[model samples]
Target: MTDTHCTLDICTPDLVKARLAEAADTLRRLPSARLTAKLTAWPDVVQSAATAYGYEAAQTRPAAPSPEAISRMDETLGWLFWIENDGRRLLWARALGVPWRKLEDLDGRSHVTLKKQHDRLLGEIAQRLAGLPAAMH
Candidate 1:
């Protein structure tokens, strides 16, 4: 017998998927030095984003991802820290009903500001999601 407690039925946009793929590819090609920098930097990034977005740290340890889920996420989203610019864009796309690719054309500084907007939006989403019943997870 097998148990699968949850499934994500939502469909992400194609543009969002492509962006995630690119981020993943970039992560894969990073030299060891850059990889180390990312790992060192990511925790602060996640914590800041989570705080800005209002996600309480899991009171208990988070459940480990099943191998299948981990593989699928890596294949789909590259690395899994929650605060990447690409992840923020996907959140914006969901909130604003704009295509993710539109965000890519933005200049670097504008993109950073847009990403901050995305973070705020994601924080709202997190708050709403926290209120939903467990079955909705």
Candidate 2:
């Protein structure tokens, strides 16, 4: 059996998962390339046209995240501090919809192992946030 539940002012693996997912979504909703004055003011017509062509390549872009979401995203980013770098990367990558199979090649870990690590890391973070210890859990 594994421990994944905790109460923290509003903390738990479930909430961490939700927050990470929302943070990832918020990140994707951010604005992309911008038309800077320099790019727009290229004196050479050929260069200007080329720049415009590249910008048009993107058929559509998601609307930028709202100010409130961005602020929440900032707070969510701080949650990464509760764990080590590896855990932070794993949680973020998973939240971003990276497949376990894909991560296996990059991380050299089986999906089962990866899943265990992810669950354990999430539990660790939730415990820290709730000010609980492994013994009590």
Candidate 3:
């Protein structure tokens, strides 16, 4: 089974999925050729229109992750799922919303090690999310 716990302030996977669906719907409503023409004909004007109106375009909350970005994240998560070591795999799993565990079988590792790995995985995920061009974090 997979976990779906909320670990931070960002929306959950389910919410992100819903947002992606909404974004798709929004894109479908527009006439692609006309939208493309407007964008291509006046790239600078279209990009700056929001800013010209005193809108802090970049500072505002970002839209949901782009389809490509979500695909990349899903791929990364799959990689995490296959970690060879149970302890390390468990740590990565926690980042993907898996519940925390005691890992009684991994005797060589202590509580401190588990906590450190969890924190490290989280830091890595945060960095990855920060670098994504269209991801919400």
Candidate 4:
């Protein structure tokens, strides 16, 4: 496939980055403790609002998140965290124009398996994007 051949309308490198970033922002805004744990496990830094507020405020747990909010956060985790590291590498490699053979060699996966992983990740991300509200897009 050519660099411009994006399968899903929202799967272009820019859209993928935007969607993933929006998802991350949604996760950070959620009030659920469970969702906060999801961010905690993420490699990136997550600044809790309470931390900036002061020590007294940090002691209090956030209120329960609305069901819609929880659903959004869960979807984000599904896309970003459920996939293993190798799957994420395929995404990054493709986005950055790395050769497929090199990725296969680096990750020790066969060509067929690598392609399958790439397609699967794209499909999953596409599905999740579809489920989100149109306003989010």
lDDT per residue as tens, model 2, 32-100: 556354576656555566576785455676877889778767777887887889889999999999999
How do the residues 36-118 of candidate 1 rate in per-residue lDDT, one tens digit apiece?
Answer: 67886635545476677878655443344455554544543422244567655555354444544566565344556766666
TM-score (all chains, Cα) for each model: 0.28, 0.71, 0.33, 0.42
Decreasing TM-score order of the candidates:
2, 4, 3, 1
TM for candidate 3 is 0.33
Each prediction's Cα lDDT score?
0.47, 0.76, 0.46, 0.59
**Which runs of model 3 end up more than 4 angstroms from their true locations?**
1-88, 92-101, 135-137
Model 1 compared with the native: what TM-score? Answer: 0.28
Instruction: Tell me the spans in candidate 2 whose CA falls farther than 4 Å from its real position.
Output: 1-9, 33-58, 132-137
What is the alpha-carbon lDDT for the whole of candidate 4? Answer: 0.59
Candidate 1 local lDDT, residue 107 = 38
Candidate 4 lDDT over residue span 52-92, tens digit each: 55644345544555676466545544566646786776775
What C-alpha lDDT, on a 0 to 100 scale, does residue 6 get in candidate 4?
A: 21
In candidate 4, stretches whose alpha carbon ends up further than 4 angstroms from where it belongs are 1-82
Error of 4 at 22 (Å): 15
Q: Which stretches of candidate 1 lie over 4 Å from their true place?
A: 1-89, 92-109
Clashing pairs in 2: none
What does candidate 3's lDDT look like per residue over 43-136, in tens digits? 5654566677877736543444567545545544443433346534654434444334445344456666766765555455544444555433
Pairs with steric clashes in candidate 3? none
Worst 10 residues of 2 by lDDT: 1-10
Clashes of each: 1, 0, 0, 0
Give the local distance difference test score of model 3.
0.46
